[model samples]
Target: MLNNNLTWKTSPCSHSEWSQSDLVRGSRILYSQQWTLITDSNDHKSIRTVLPPGPCVPVSGEVLSGLSGHQLLEIWDRHGLRKCLNLTALNKHGRVYDDAQFGCLSWSECENKLLYVAEKIKNTSIEKHDGESPCRKPQQDRSVYCEDWGESLTNKSVPVICVVNLQSGSISVLQGVPHDVSPGQALWAPSSQSVFLVGWYHEPFRLGLRFCSNQRLSGDNLSVSCPRLSPDGSTLFYLQGRVFGPHNQCLSLQQVHYLYLLVVFRLLCSGFPSSLIFFVFVVASSAGFYDLPDYGSWKLLTVQKDLMVVCCSSPNTPPTLRVGFLPSAGETVTWQTLQQPVMTFDFHWTVLDVTTPPEEDNTHYSGLDFGAVLVKPSRPPIEAKTPLVVFIHGGPHSQFPAEWNCTTAGLAKLGFAVLMVNYRGSTGFGQDSILSLIGQIGSQDVKDVQTAVRTALQRDIALDPNRLAVIGGSHGGFLSCHLVGQYPEFYRACAARNPVINAATLLGTSDIVDCVGIQYSYDQIPTAEALAAMLEKSPITHAAQIKAPVLLMLGGRDRRVSPHQGLELYKALKSRASPVRLLWFPEDGHSLSRVDTQADCFLNTVLWLHQHL
Candidate 1:
C-alpha cells in the first residue's frame, strides 16, 4: 500500500531573515571553497568535518573544485595568506598568498593521488612603492582575458597541473601540457594514472578536453566541457555549448574509446557554462544521451553498492542530497530526495518564453529552445500587475541557475517579482544556443530581453510591465544598460554593476581582450570598420536614448571588465545630464557583489527601484 498525505509549502523568504554566515551559494558557486562533510555511512547520522591543519577556518576564500571520498583536501586564504591542505598533514603555501590563485581539485581513482591546477608563485622579494602600497603595475605580456587563466585572479596566471602522491609525499608538475595552454577542470579516470583535462589552448584560443598518461598530454582530443567519468569508469558525461550524437566500432579520441562518435569539431565557444547540461555516454559502446536538467548544479556525493549518492539544486532550492538507484537491465529506475542541511525553498516558480527568429534570419543561430523564469513574491502586489525587477546574468556565455540566491530573495522581500532570462549564448543550454550570441550581441540579445518582458506581461498576471527595473553585473550589466537605452520606455530604472559600456574602448584595457573579438566578431587589431561595428554593438551607442536613472556599482580592482568599462558608461550618461550614481568597491575584484558586498548591492538596488521605478 502507498500512502499519500504530503504537499509542498512555500514560505515568505525574508531577505534579512537568515544570518550572513548561514547563507550559502548554490553548489557550483561554492566550487571547492566550503567544507564538505560526509555523514558516517555506518551511523547515517553523525557528520565528519573535513578540516585543515590546526583546524583553521576558511575565510574570504573558496574551494578550488571537486572532492574525492578517501581523504579530504582544501585550499583557503586568510589574512592574505593562502594554504592548500590535505588531511591536516599536507600543507603548502606561497611566499605570499595574496598573489596565489588555485584552480579545480580532483582525487585520483586510487585515492592516493591528488591533481590540481594553480599559478606558480613568484618570488616575494619585490619592494613596495614608497614602502607602503603593494599595488603593482600591469604586466604587459600577460593574456588579455583573466578568466581564460583561471589560476590567477588579479591577472591571467601562468597555469599548470600538478599531481601529488599521498603515500610517498612526492609531487610532480605536469610538463607535457604546453605553456600556452591554460589547463582547468581536471579529473582522474578509472585507471587512476590517466587524467582527463579541459584546457584553454592558445594560438586561436579555444577550449578542448585532452587525455594525459604517464605525465604526457596526448594530441588526441575532443572539444568538450564539464567532462566526468561515471562510477564504474566506463562512461563519460559532458555538455558541449552547441553540439552532440554517436555509432558501431570503438574509435579513440584523446585516448578514450568512443564506439560511434559524430564530431563536427567547432572552435571552442567563449566562457564556461555558469550552469551545466548533463550528458552521459557509454565509453566502450556507440551510445550517448543528452536529456538531463538544462539548469542547475549536480555533484556526485558518494557511491555505495548499487546506490549513488548525489546532490542536485537550482536557484530556488539549496543542494539536496538524494539517492539514485543505478539502472538495471529491465528494472524501473528510482531516485529519492534526501534531506538538506538547510531549508530555503520559499518562493514560487513560473515559466516564461522568449521569441526566437527563424533560421533564415541568421544561419549561425542555434537556439533550439529559449526559456526564462518569473519568481513571484510571497505576498500579492498592491496593484493588479506586480512591479517587476528583471535580472540579466553576465557572461553572455553564462546562465543563472535555479538554485537559491540571497540577492534575489532579498529583492523579492521588497515586494518585487524577479524575472531571470537565459538569453542566447547563455550556458546550461547546449553549445548551439551558447554560441548564438557570438555575432549578434546588441540586437539579438536586446530583442530576447524584450521578448521575455512581453511574455511575462502576457502570461504572468503578477508582473507589471510598465513599472519595471533592471539589474545585472558584467555582461548582465551591459544588457541592463542596453535595455534602459534601446527599449527606454520599458524599464523605469536601471542598476548596473561593473557593466561593459564601450567595447571598442574596453578592447585594449580589459583583460578578456580576445573575448571582444571572439564574441563580437572582430579582428585582433580593429580596423575602422571593426571599430565602427563594435561601437554600433555597444550599449553606449544608445546612451542618448535612455531616459531612466541608472545606478552604477563598479569594482576598483576588477581585472576582467576593468572599472573603466563602468566609468565610461557613467561618464557618457552624465555628459547628457542623465541621472546616474557610481559606487566603487576598492578591495574587491571582478566579482564585486559576491560575499562581502552582496547585501549592500541588494539593499541599494531595492532602494533605487523604490525611488525611481
Candidate 2:
C-alpha cells in the first residue's frame, strides 16, 4: 500500500543556538583516580587523582573521537565482550538491536546539535483504502494479535534520526529522511548548522556514508566503517570494506569531502581534474592511501590538526597507540608512538603465506593466498622447540588480525607458539576472498587451514610438528575437528568449542541455520542435492578417520550453534571409544569462552593439551 500520510515533528524543546565551547565544558569533572573503601579499618580512605605513568589504552572497540576535549570510551567487561558489549552485557542483555554504532549516539562539535538515531513511530495515521491489503495497518498500530507481535511490530518499525539542542534542551526529529534509509553514525561537518555525515542502511542490508539529506557518496557494493570528516572538511578519512567482491583486504581512503555546494561551483567553473576524479573510478578496485605507512587493519581514532591518532597491536606486541601527522607536500609524516602495554609473555610474530599451488590438471586458478600470524616466545632457546597451538577464529568471515589477543598470548605463555589463521573466507581481505569459502566450507576452508599449518612447518616457524595441537570455536571449531578427522596423523590433540560437526543437522536446528546452509551449500534449507552437499561438507562425514584425542566445550544457551551439536560429536566420539571429554557451560551461549567461562575453558584446554600432547 502506497500511503503518503507520513509526518514528522520535534519533541519538547526550546529555541536556542549551540556553540563549541558548550561541548568542551562539562558539568562534572572527569577524574583519573580510582576510589576504594578501606573496609578493613572501618574508615574509608581516599587518594588524590594521579596520572598513570604508563600508556593509557582503550578497553575495547574503536576509540570514539569526540570533537571537543571529550572522548567516548568503551568500558570493557571482563566477561564476554564480543557477544553483548560492555554496559549491556554487564546488565544481562544480548542478541538485541545494536544502537551504539552509526550516529545513534553522537554529539556535534558545535555542541548545539546532538544527533541520535532510533526506532520510532511517525505521528500521522494512515487511512485504510479499499484496494489496500488487509495486512496493511495504520503506521503506528498499538494492536497486538495472537501474541505474534513480531510481524506487526516489524511492519511498523521505523528508524528515525532526532537532533537535540544542548542549550535549550529542544529535540527535533528531522523531516524528509525516508523510512527505507536507516540513518546512524551522524557526524557534524565543519562550519555546519545542519550538514553532517550520516551512515545510512538500505533494505536487504547495505551501509554507506551519505550527506544528512540522504544522498549516498559511495557505490552500493562498498561498506563504510568509521567515516570521519577532516578538520578542514576537504577529505573524509574512512576505512572502506567491500560488502561483496573477490578482494579480502580492506583499505583506508581519503575521499573528497563533498559539501555539495563546493562541488557544483568547482565542477562548473574549473571542471573535475585528473587527480580529483581518480577516486571516482578506483573505489571499486584495490585502494588505500599509498603514501602513508601501512598500519594493518587500522581504525582512524581521532584527527588533530595535521596529526591522526590510531591504536593498533600485533600478535607479538600488546595494545599500542600512535599519532602520525600527515606530511606537508613532499615531507614524510612523523609518527609519535606511545609506550605500548607489555604483556607477561614476550612474543615475536611473523606472517606465513599459505599460497595454494595450481591443480595437477592445470586449472586456470593461480591459487588464493591466505596468511596466518605465528607468535612465539622471544626466548631464543625455547622458541624453536615450543609446542604449537593453531588458533582459528569463528566467523570464518572474521579475520584473525595481526593484533594482540589475550587468548593466543596465554597459549604462548604456556609454552606454545600460537598461530592465528586468517583463512580464505576472512574479511579485511575484501568481499571476494571472504565469499571464497562460501560453498567450500569443508574442502577449501579446511585445506586453507591445513595449508597454513603446513606453510608454518615448511618455513620452520613451528620447528616441532609432532608437538602440535589445534583449537578453535564455531567455524574454527569445525576446522579443528575436521583436521583431526581428515588428517588423523597430523594433529596429536584437538579442542573444539561449540563446533559444527554436522551441517545437515545444524541447518534445521541452529538459529542462524540459513547462514550455514547458504555458506556451506550456497542454498537455503537444502532438500535434494543441496542436502547431500551439506552432509558431505560436515565434519561428521569423516568422523571415522579421527585418531587424535579431543576435548569439546559446549555452550548450553547457544542459539547460534546449539549445545546439542557439540553433544552429538561427544556421543559419536564416546561410542567410538576415542579419548574425548565434554565440558558444558550451562549458562553461556555460542561465545562460551568469552567471559564467565574463559577461565574454566583456558584451564581445561591447557590441561587437555598438556595431557595429550
Best by lDDT: 1
lDDT of 1: 0.57
Residue 205 displacement in candidate 1 (angstroms): 9.9
Q: Name the lDDT value of residue 216 in candidate 2.
A: 34
- Kindly list the per-residue Cα lDDT of model 2 for residues 242-303, writing each as its tens digit: 44332224455646555442321111211111111212211212112235443444545544
Candidate 1 regions with alpha-carbon error over 4 angstroms? 1-152, 159-304, 312-316, 327-334, 340-346, 357-369, 382-384, 514-523
TM-score of each: 0.66, 0.65
- TM-score leader: 1
**Candidate 2 deviant stretches above 4 angstroms:** 1-103, 119-159, 170-182, 188-227, 233-300, 340-345, 360-365, 378-385, 427-432, 508-525, 557-559
